[model samples]
Target: MRRFFAYLTAFIREDFNLRLYAGTAAFVAAMTAFNYAVDLEDGIIDKHRGEVLRFWLYAGLDAFMYYSVTVFWLLANRQLSILKTARFWLFSLAAIGVLAWWQDYTGYSKVVGLPVFGEIYSFAHYCFSNLSSALTVWVPFAVFYLLVDRQPSHFYGFRPDWLSLKMYGILLLLMVPLIAWASFQPSFLQTYPIYKGWGAARALHWPEWIPAVIFELCYGFDFISTELIFRGFLIIGMMQVVGRGAVLPMVAVYATVHFGKPLGETIGSVFGGYILGVLAYQSRTIWGGIAVHLGVAWLMELGAFLQSFVHSPEK
Candidate 1:
């Protein structure tokens, strides 16, 4: 117990040099205000025009929020020179804008070899969108790191620490009771297991496990992209430029993405993002964060599934 508190407090001393705690708070406030100004939804792609509109609207806003946070991060760190920053922003935002707009298509899947994907259309779409989204940051990051920033290796935040993973596992274990409690809440159950809208199995009439597997794969890939952007690119990539301040800004931006979640979760994400940022910076690995993220998500999904099964067997 004493050691745990020591590790917890020492995290601030060791990994929380970010003078940008206020900045993170400010960003979250501004984002909360913006969300109040609009109706945000998780993207749901469909041939119907209404769903397409929702996808572009939410995705465009999310892209703006995320990349704008990135710009603020680079500015605060001043990691790159004026010209380089300008160039980076121009191309990076352009890529995100173009790809997001492209995703608004009714025929996008067919154009991108969905016919070949056949039964795994959901998986293919998942791969295409997620990989494209990952590339939006990764490509420019690669060029900037290699050519401009001059990193020795492009490892990003992919470092692994098996011994330290125990620490993260413990953290997840500690959350089980809280998550279980939340599972009993109607609001929590309704909001969580967020992939129900995808409806891959019902739409395709395939085995339920097919969609479950695809969704999990998609969740895993998406989390990897997220870790790279926040923990890897923003935290580690900008560490030299901004010191520990990098983590806080990433935390702020991460919490912003959780805007549409329940109030408790959106608020919890602020701290969650901060902790993951610290873990990535200290261990120089996003694996622990990934494990915690996937574990928490699947656990939430399972909890929700169990509750629904017990109460509403028709579901």
Candidate 2:
């Protein structure tokens, strides 16, 4: 715990520009407010869901603006030479924009058509959607690491020794009460236990827990891709160009990704993303962030399940 705090403190000491931090915070807050105030993501962007080209364009622009504006702020304040690293800045923003679109893309359903899979389409789609992040985020980044960055180190924070799960476990423990508290909120329950069972368990004549567990596992695995992109790629990969300045921009955009989620969750992502960003910057590994993320997500699932079970009419 002390070690984690030390990492955060050290990063702050090195890169704590009051104007940069304050301006970035104001930007994130304003965007978050605008998004939720009019229900921009769920109401507007998602309304175009399944319209592949349109959805991609909207989401991509949204993500790119958040990231680029934050980076612009950093460059303005720090007077960083953007001309020298223009290629990297463009590539990073474009990749992140495409990633944002891909994360929510519903066009995958067409590929898993019900005509082919019959009653299993729901289950198949659910699992595929959850697990596809590995391919979507990891493959491109891996190729970029090999062909472009060519860093002779572990590919963007995959170094095992740089992570301390014990410390992350402690962080998870601290979050238990918070997750439990969130489970009782009407909004939280509505979105959690993210496994809907989708009637697939009944259709397949299988126990409900089977599909639930499968969905949970696939759901948890998606966070690895998230950590890879946000912490590993954004912080560690971009460190060469932006140094410690990467963390705040990453935090700003990270919060935007959660805009479609509950307001509290979106707000929480800012703090969580920052701490993980700092840790990734200091340790040069993403394993600890993965651990805490997976733990909190699964715990939220467990909390929601227990809450629902206790309130179920069957009970």
Candidate 3:
């Protein structure tokens, strides 16, 4: 815990520019407010879900605007230099665009339509959709790392270190009460546990827990991809270009990506993304972030599950 605070304090002391931080915060707050007010993500971007190019374009532009604007602010303030690294920025934005597109992409619906999968299509589709994030997000970034980054260290924070795990666990423990409180909210319940089973259990004559457990595993895996992208790729990978200035831009865009989620969660992401970005920057490892993320995510699932079970009419 002390170590975590030390890292955060050091980063802030060295990197905290009042104007830049305030400007970025204001930008993020306004963007978040407008997004929720207009239901931008659900009403606007997601409306093009199945239209591959259109969805990609909308999601990509949304992410690009948030990220680019923050970076632009950094540039305007003389905090970042894009002189020779134009290609890196372009590639990074393109990769973020691809990830945004892939995240909500509905192209997999075609596969779910096949008759071979039978009544279990819902279960299969749910699992496949979540699991595919690993491929979509990681593959492009991996290629980028090999071709461009080729950093001498481990692959964007995948290196193992058992020492930090305890700190991460304590962080997760601290989040327990907050997550439990969220579970009782009308909005949180509406979105959480993420797997409705889509009637897969009834159709297949299988226990609901089977599909739920499988879905939870896949859902948890998506967080690994998330940590890799936001904490690992965006913060660590971009640090080479922007130095410690990478954290806020990543936080702004990270919050943007959460627009479709419950409002509180979206708001929480700004803080969460910032903390994880700073920690990742300091430790040069994403494993701790991964642990805390997966732990909090799964805890939310559990809380939602327990809430549902307790409130079920059958009970």
- Model 2, span 1-315: residue lDDT tens: 888889889988877777777777877888889998989788887777667655565656556655665566567556456535776666576457556655566656776786866777877888888778766787788778778788889988888853377778889899999889989999888888787777888887899988888888888878888888889888898877767767777887788778888798899899889999998898888889999989988999899999999999999
Report how far off residue 134 is in candidate 3 (Å).
2.7
- CA deviation > 4 Å runs, candidate 2: 52-73
Candidate 1, lDDT over the whole model: 0.64
> Residue 315: error of model 3 in Å?
4.1
Q: List the candidates ranked by lDDT, beginning with the highest.
A: 3, 2, 1
In angstroms, what RMSD does candidate 1 have relative to the true structure?
5.9
TM-score each candidate: 0.68, 0.90, 0.89
Alpha-carbon runs more than 4 Å astray in model 1: 1-8, 14-27, 37-150, 195-206, 312-315
Considering TM-score, which of the candidate structures 1 and 3 is the better prediction for this target?
3
RMSD of each: 5.9, 2.4, 2.4
Q: How would you encode candidate 1's per-residue C-alpha lDDT over 1-315 as one tens digit per residue?
A: 343345467767654325444565677777776664553433222333435564566456556665555556556556546326554455344334433443343344454564666655655575566555454555666676667666665467766678667878888898899889989998887677655635557667888877777666766676766676677876776666556656665675577567656666788888888778877777777787888887888888888978877888575
- Minimum summed lDDT over a 10-residue window in model 3 is located at 76-85
Q: Could you tell me how far off, in angstroms, the CA of residue 289 lies in candidate 1 after the best superposition?
A: 0.7
Best by lDDT, which number?
Answer: 3
Model 3 per-residue lDDT tens digits across residues 37-124: 9888888777776776556656665566556655755675575556456865665675576567666667667777799767878778
